[model samples]
Target: MFHVALTGLLTGLALIVAVGAQNAFLLRQGIRGEQVLPIVLTCLLSDVVAITAGVAGLGIVLERWPSVLPVAQVLGGLYLIAFGIHAAMRAWKPTALTTEGGASLTVGKAIVLTLALTWLNPHFYLDAVLMLGTVANSFGEDRWWFLSGTLLASLLWFFGLGYGARLLRGLFARPSAWRVLDSGIAVLMGVLGVGLLAH
Candidate 1:
């Protein structure tokens, strides 16, 4: 059981730790100390749903009807492009983070954006749903244990990322830092978006 759980935890971390659109957004939120809790919770819940659905056989459904992936890819690609454009605009007129505050986003808007980023990314389903699900089931009777490990990993990672970002707040106090970060985000989104579309 320990081995199974460890495997699941390690596997989950391996797949999720990759720098991607979702992580980037969360990092930005964390650094700014803006709506961090809601965004983190949204990410955690999204992972739980996707991972659980995968274990429950949603992965198989997707595999059987492979056409679903392309549609997701196209939509996700376009959405990412649009998001990138927004980031680029922000980068152009970068603002500094202050101890007092910085740009503000309503919790509602942030959560909605979080959901869109989470659900619209095809890679999320591919990794969390299809890949993780297949791996968990391989453990047979120990599948639930594996699932537990994965969940634990998700919990730790999201909280760590969201909260950890606060450590960088000081570094981002300069408008120059904000410009660099936003520029990077824009580039990342564009690359990922085009990659998705081309796939």
Candidate 2:
């Protein structure tokens, strides 16, 4: 059981550590210091759902559906490219000292955007659900223990990412810092999209 739990924890972290839209959004929101708690919780909850589905064998079902993969990949790729372009455009634009003047994003918008960022990516389902589930299968009935560990890992990571940004809010308040952060995100997102296309 301990081995299973350890494997799950590491696997969960490894799967999530990649550069992707969801992580980019979380980082940006953290920098912006807007609705951090709700955003983080939503992300974590989303992970919970996906991970649950994967552990429960839903992932295997989805993976076997050949028609779904291409469409999902296309949509996910397009969305990533669009978001990357938008972020890059923002970086190119003049910076304001106080972004607080802009209209804050509503909870509904945040939730929708988060879902798109997370669920729309076929790769997300592939990695977190399908791949992880397949691996968990090796544990037999002990897969439950593995999944519990993975779920806990997700909770820890999301909370750390969401709330952790608060510590750097002062730096993000600086125009130069914001510029660097946004530019980095733009570059990361663009590269990820390009990689997806190549794959």
Top TM-score model = 1
Candidate 1 runs further than 4 Å off: 96-102
Report the C-alpha displacement of residue 100, candidate 2, in angstroms: 2.8
After TM-score superposition, the amount by which residue 32's alpha carbon in candidate 1 deviates from its true location, in angstroms, is 0.4
Among all windows of ten consecutive residues in candidate 2, which has the lowest summed lDDT? 94-103
Best by lDDT: 1
Number of backbone clashes in candidate 1: 0
> lDDT by residue for model 2 over 1-199, one digit each (tens)?
9989999999999988766789878877876777777778888898888887888898779867867877877788777788888777776665433346334778888888888888878888888788888888879999988998888888888888877877888877777776777688778877777766666
Go through the candidates in order and give each one's C-alpha lDDT.
0.89, 0.79
lDDT of 1 by residue, 1-199 (tens): 9999999999999988878888999999998888999999999999999999998888889889989999999999999988999888888863433433446889999999999898999999999999999999888889888988999999999999999999998898887888888889999999999999999
Per-residue lDDT of 195 in model 1: 97
Residue 86 deviation, candidate 1, in Å? 0.7
Whole-structure CA lDDT of model 1: 0.89
